[model samples]
Target: MKLSDRQEKIIDLVRVGQPVTSVALADKLGVTRAALRADLAILTMIGTLDARPKVGYVYSDKPKRNLLLDYISDIKVSEIMSKPAVISESTMVYDAIVYLFLNDVGTVFVENNGNLVGAASRKDFLKISIGGTDIHKVPVGIIMTRMPNIICGRADDSAYEIASKIIEHEIDSIPIVETLKVDGDKEQYKIIGKVSKTNITKLFVKMGKSK
Candidate 1:
């Protein structure tokens, strides 16, 4: 949820001070108590502040920690995923190399008919290139590791789950995908985005700095 300037200031004030009374807060903020009612109510309802009949508003440690954990675990892949590097399944290995370098991504999703068919990584391209073959003529589909064999994540999957998949598979990234049914019950997935180890690290750093 987007927070207004006053709401953000309220949070900062509560964080740095002890429980504060509405009168004192309003005086300090140069606003009337009535003006703060909605802000305080929203903060309390959202578990950001604890209010008592006479004790005023306080930031509860336990609730704040729980909120942080919930935020991390409930974060969807779509929230943190980056635009996926993609190539047509029919793209030549030579062209794929050029695209990969231009995009500066370790892996690229290979698509056919709008469906994710496979993936090619820098390692995959290097392996073929080292063989002294005519990569310029070889379709990436022939060298890519196909679906069902590729590890992937869903767009709605939690970021925590995506991070786990990356570690468990020992891969640099996982494609965020959506499942589609085709051909009388056969299912295929379309690539939407990518979650990488770097993304997880950035999350960790952000959480740490906030704490």
Candidate 2:
């Protein structure tokens, strides 16, 4: 959400001149009109400036909300989440890695009896691969980071919160889960979908294209 110095300057010029044309702003800033296009578009997208037909750029007195953040915070996980790649916990690491490649995913969720139990990443597979362990005999269940320890998200969770968890946990993806049954202190969850780094990046890219 940090604006560059040039972007700050562009805001200042538009504010002082009020309804300044892109051509005038570019001239004052000693840049071409094309160079100002991106900045102007970003300002307008962020609610910092308003563009009027037949007019020019004028500062928007409305609340300056970071539109990207606004979109993320308001967006639900189910809106952007992709179908998660899943494998049985008993699947061999070698087979799991192959499945991971076939599905084009960085992480794979491991389930037992249709309940989410664990997750494993490419890094984990690679680590085991080079360790001289017989991957064919090494089940994903043993290598996978088990549930209650793995971070998870709900269908109703905000995309922003899930994205933050991805950063905070230093993981590639989060499994979106639904509570199934409670066994005393233990709870079972069914994997529904997942939100990954690629999803968040695409969301940002789409939001950035806003007018």
lDDT of 1 at 188: 81
Estimate, for each residue in 1-211, the C-alpha lDDT of model 1 and write its tens digit.
Answer: 6889999899888878758888988988999999999999888877888897788788865544656668888888888899999999889999999999999999989998889989998889999999998999999999999888989898888988898889888888899888899998999898889998878888788767853
Off by over 4 Å in 1: 1-71
| Model 2 Cα lDDT, one tens digit per residue, 42-82 | 88988899998778999987635666467668999999899
In order of listing, the candidates' clash counts read: 0, 0
User: What alpha-carbon RMSD in Å does predicted model 1 have with respect to the real structure?
Assistant: 8.0
Per-model TM-score versus the true fold: 0.65, 0.69
Q: Mark the regions of model 2 whose C-alpha exceeds 4 Å error after superposition.
A: 1-63, 66-68, 182-186
Global lDDT scores for all candidate models: 0.88, 0.91
